[model samples]
Target: MAYSFPEEVLEHVFSFLRSDRDRNAVSLVCWSWYEIERWCRRRVFIGNCYAVSPEIVIRRFPKVRAVEMKGKPHFADFNLVPEGWGGYVQPWIRAMAASYPSLEEIRLKRMVVTDESLDLIARSFKHFKVLVLSSCEGFTTDGLASIAANCSNDSVARLRFSRTSNNVSTTKLLNLREIDLRESEVEDLSGHWLSHFPHNCTSLVSLNMSCLGSEVNFPALERLVGRCPNLRTLQLNRAVPLEKLPNLLHRAPQLVEFGTGAYSAEIRPDIYSNVAEAFSVCKQLRGLSGFWDVVPAYLPAMYSACAGITSLDLIYAAIQSPDLVKIISLCPHLQCLWVLDYIEDAGLEALAASCKDLQELRVFPSDPFEAEDNVALTEQGLVSVSEGCPKLQSVLYFCRQMSNAALITIARNRPEMVRFRLCIIEPQAPDYLTLEPLDTGFGAIVENCKELRRLSMSGLLTDRVFEYIGKHAKKLEMLSIAFAGDSDMGLHHVLSGCDSLRKLEIRDCPFGDKALLANAAKLETMRSLWMSSCLVSYGACKLLAQKMPRLNVEVIDERGHPNSRPENCPVEKLYIYRTVAGRRVDMPDFIWTMDKNAGSPEVL
Candidate 1:
């Protein structure tokens, strides 16, 4: 079919489609469509900062105004990635400073953003409106002060930070709508910063400072809430006592999301009732979290707001089965739930009975080293939930033992599941009943759940499960394997097929360099491949790097072996990704970039 539209018309038409996926698809049609799509792109998301050089991005998409970039692999969240491991923001900032003068917003995650980077951003962009940094480090209070002073326009509505700024006495954060200072280093800011918001400003919609350590003036908070009627999400730290919770909730009854301040306080019955009454008025509550050191006695106070809630996070609360049951009973509308393993099978049964709308559930281990008998739930709980919640879509179950029957039952019951992660606390656990390999059980999942996007496999397994995954799980994008697969053939099977696979994470597996090199072609299409504690060798890694010039093959030697020879040593960790940027200069001393053109690449 011949295209009818001219270049400008096609570009304008494609501009209506906001999704990057859609734009990417259209770009593949022809050279004309690709050029139009590139020119029309106003927003861009780079999963990895180094996937493409900033110069390449500027040359390709000159109109990009909003940029969201993620640095440091996802494992960095678990502290697996060492300190000073390189997700630096300087290189990208320098590139953007020259290319994207019109860039209005930037969102960064797990990146090291220094004061210099922030200052450059503040001074570079004339219309800079938003700057968000999550799980980022290396910037101090002075950096935030620079942002506050320079980006004072009403367009700058949101700000995120960790430390308290003492010099913001005249900081004009005009029309500020959201202030998120989550998990900050400062213990006390004297709550005086609350007065910084303009007197007439009522645009605030979200305020999260759940890590603040000092007591806040209740009256000031009350006045702030009263002024900002649009406030829908509020997270208070433990410094706010239970007695003050009632007043705060009453002030913001229209809140759709809330993070309750310390639930550990011992309060009088009247005070508890006040708290309950305050919750009762919150008719729009949908998400609730933050119950630090939860007291069972105060659990009932939350009943009124539970009915409308869809997401409840109580991973930090150690409430036993009975209290959990009471809460679950009220939360019939729940679609997502996170709880400690203390909620035993009985609690799960209660959930199945009440939360028929449940779509996601995560049961985290309270004590990973607890004895077998001390564990909370097992296959029974999983089977029970599977039978009850037919709409279940995702689960992260941490248990002591599981059965093949339970897994198969779950697969058959919830065939539409998008994510299924079952972690037996004990590694390489087998079917409790048959004492056999769990290959068949996992095979059932891949065969049954055709729409599965993510799967984390555990238990005793062989190459057969990988074969099933590669052949049957066509839609699987992410696969996490740990302490299971038999040989190189296991990794080979998955890599040879599973065409849609984007990320493969393997740890403590037997697969080595042969398996890594076998999927050389497959690795280019993938976003990333992370293998740790495998039998991969340095020689094979160098060979793989030599073969795939576009791929960044990195060996992360967490064990300080700086003096170790590359050819003789085992590549304990391997991180490989296809990038427009040949090799990042910010890589740490411990990270060896093994590409053949280690220090050279043609400019894009």
Candidate 2:
């Protein structure tokens, strides 16, 4: 087929090409392609690895837009890439400074920077709009002063100095619309000094100064928000301590995204009420989080405040009443709702009724309920919810009871669902769960949800469940089954059917090494695997890993199990077998071996 569109469409298609080798293809194409070369401004990995440098390679394209220097140490010596790979990285950062005039964004990562580099960047990169010097330890606020001095007249809009000790003279920062000093260790600063933040940074959309050490004031943050009315997100987790949340929220009405950590009583009489009152002030908050775990009293108030929020991340927010119905009803435009609570079917039923437009749902049940937890919902609620919410792409549940019938109903109703969470709340009560295998329910998930890409199953699942998985779920790419009694059925079933699987995590699932060796060869496409338990066997570990050389396998022992009743005892004997080669070598069985870390990765 011959291309119909002009040079511009193809140029846009090649915009994501970050590799150096592909840039050569564009250059060799034709003189017509030279016009498109300038569009490939986001050059990646130059100098050390390749003979050609960006300055030389980008000769035909002078109007470069951005450059990302990948080599850098996040901590003192911890380079983001391998140690030997960094000598190839610094030359490119120098190249970014020397070249690229039209550059708007520059990310100089790790600790691979110097004062001179910062100066070169501040002075040379005139239109450096977004600069992220994350984990770059060689910086001081004076370097930032250089940027403020040079790019004061330029379009340096957003500056993020994350995990850096670079002391930024807050007063010198006057051009940026968004200033992220998140996790930046500045020794001395107060709310008063923060007043100097570039008031001209009017386009500031997100400001994350949460981890920055400073006695912040709502007045200063309000000023920051007032100057930039378009600001949508503000994270002052502990900046202002607990004293200034209300003033900040009330002043910044345009703020839609907000996150705060635990505050001091000086901010509000009681932490809960103060946080609740603070939340109530934000009328348009779309995405809000923190202060995890909520009490019933605060639920209504939170809903009242974030009335217009579309994405609510109340990971620890308390929701006890059917008031969840009123909350969703209040936020009629709500799209994504995450309740990190021991959510009951009744509450979910209410949520289903009120928040019909929900696209993604995450519910974590923190309560310890008996086996009755699984019977909360019948097959009908699943059908109703899956059918009712036409836009729902992902559903996650923890505390709620789930049966085979309900899963089938969900599959029958919403086959296009991308992600699903089925959990059985194991109780600590004296009576055993009598392990009723919901064959019907597990089968529905495997067969129906054709678009099922991610699945997380909680509680104990047995080996018999494998046949169910092998029969239905072939499209799964990521699977997480955490905290369960000894069971190998699910693992075997998954390996047999889920051929396209890429990421697999079996947390606290007792699938010993023998089972792994048996199923190892079937999982060739798997790229990442995490087994956190002592149930893995040595023979299976080598067999699987050796067979799939590409497997990024991590086998670790989670020694301290959830000291809860239903949780199993932390494996103690497995520690004796780990070897560099792995525990329990396939050659023979012995009481112990000199290889300390050997049987380790195997049965771990």
Report how far off residue 256 is in candidate 1 (Å): 0.5
| Model 1 Cα shift for residue 394 (angstroms) | 1.1
32-76 per-residue lDDT for model 2 (tens digits): 565566555455432112223455645645666655543321112
Q: TM-score of every model? A: 0.88, 0.61
lDDT of each prediction vs. the true structure? 0.81, 0.54
Best-performing candidate as measured by TM-score = 1
- List clashing residue pairs in candidate 1: none
Best by lDDT: 1
lDDT of 1 by residue, 1-604 (tens): 3278888778778878888888899999988788778888989999898788888888889988888888888767656677888888888889887888788778888888888997787667766655667777777655654554553335543444436754323222434455555543442436655654445656668777675667766676787788788899898877777778888888888999999877867668888889889989999999998888788789888888888999998886788888999899999899999998888999999999999999999999998887656645888888888899988999999888988888899999999999999888888888989999898999999999999999998888888899989889989999999898888999998998798998888888988878778789899999998888888887888788778888998888867542356564667678888898778777666787874654222121
**Could you give the C-alpha RMSD of every candidate to the true structure, in order shown?**
4.8, 10.7
